[model samples]
Target: AYIAAPEKTAQAISTMSPSLITFKLEGDHLNRLNIPVIRRCLEKATAVVVGPGLGLHKETEEALKEVLRIVEEKGIPVLLDADGLKAFANFKRRLRVPLVLTPHAGEYKILTGDTLPGKLKDRIEMVRRAAQELNAVILLKSNVDVISDGVRVKLNFTGNPGMTVGGTGDVLSGIVGAFLAQGADPFNAAVAGAFINGAAGDFVKAEKGYHMLPTDLLEWIPRVIDDPMSHVKVRRSVPRGL
Candidate 1:
């Protein structure tokens, strides 16, 4: 946010100001925003991730809805995580395009108006049920991840407890987004991302113990992606069906 732009201002100016990434924010604080810039960016985007830092303002929420509306209309692959899920809490829809949602337990409760079961099998089933209800892929964050696209399900057990550090989920979202933009399907992207992210944390734990930062995971991502299974000491059989 430039903080000087007019409310009707929608265009974005790219410069060599040396920033890693830019987020589009408006109003006094997450209020209504004119999204001509976002629209322009979408022109060149094969995939997009919404809600990493997207605030909890009405306009921000509306912007997410509008972005999804455009994605559905235009067939853009999208991943909604973090704050994005918060904005879409309690909303369900069937999208023809590739859409994957990564939500943890709290967000999951808000989404389905139901609680996940304590049993692992029952939990995976509920994740699958949510996917079916929304007609979208879901990657449930947990000690061991459960991913479902309604009919098919997979589990990931590569991550360590050190990943409780902040910014790790954001990093996972980026990895998943990159794969989506590279044309992998949502399910594959989420699975690959979950594995790589957790593996990175595992690697960090080896070198730095539980004193891990999200940046530590970043340093190990390339190695994990280069040969994902190489980092895994143990691989469990993925549960099939429901």
Candidate 2:
């Protein structure tokens, strides 16, 4: 369910217009996502996705903390994106369940406390170190997505420039969350999720080129998932320790 005040709700609704459930905030945005409500909603959730469009307003950050708390306490597998990456600044060591972090270069720097490297090898090593240190899978988004859980790395090459548009990462978080909920391990889920998310973008790009929007990419995800090879030209697997 989408949870935020009216103004935020309008923006979220525009992005997630297809969402089937929504919980609008009545007053303090933080207060709106109280533990009681979180717990109740979690009871029915197989996996949780947090931090998409979650702004850094103080109240929203507080709400993020509560969301993190419930997710940890309940051992819910979760995919953290956007503001959720900011929230991880505090809870990095507290993660106890299967968790995935999707961060672009800037966010990855903030989360890892290191400068993003210029070369591909250095970047892969950084992602690996961050995943190992945090004990979570990391999907470091870029032109060529890098996914690692410290032990293994998967490079996804199915997307295009069109996916740089806003809301694409949110679509990725949902895809990964769905995979995790369906019992894919954190690493494989991230691998497959990255593959699927990018492949969908490629599919949309085939039709719309650089004009493809996030909604188009979102709509194409299932199609890519159902016929992955059709999107990925050559399926190459990275070595276990690469």
Best by TM-score: 2
Cα-based lDDT at residue 110, candidate 2: 77
List, residue by residue over 1-242, the lDDT tens digit for candidate 2: 43433445755665755664555544544454455666677877778887886666776667777776777888889888988788677556747787799999888877878888789888998899889888889999988789999889989876777788898888888888888888889899888888888777777766766777788886777777777767544223211111
lDDT of each: 0.76, 0.76
In angstroms, the error of model 1 at 207 is 0.5
Off by more than 4 A, model 1: 1-25, 28-32, 233-242
TM-score of each: 0.85, 0.86
lDDT of 1 by residue, 47-68 (tens): 8887665667777787667777
- The list of candidate 2 runs beyond 4 A from truth reads 1-19, 232-242
lDDT of model 1, residue 51: 66
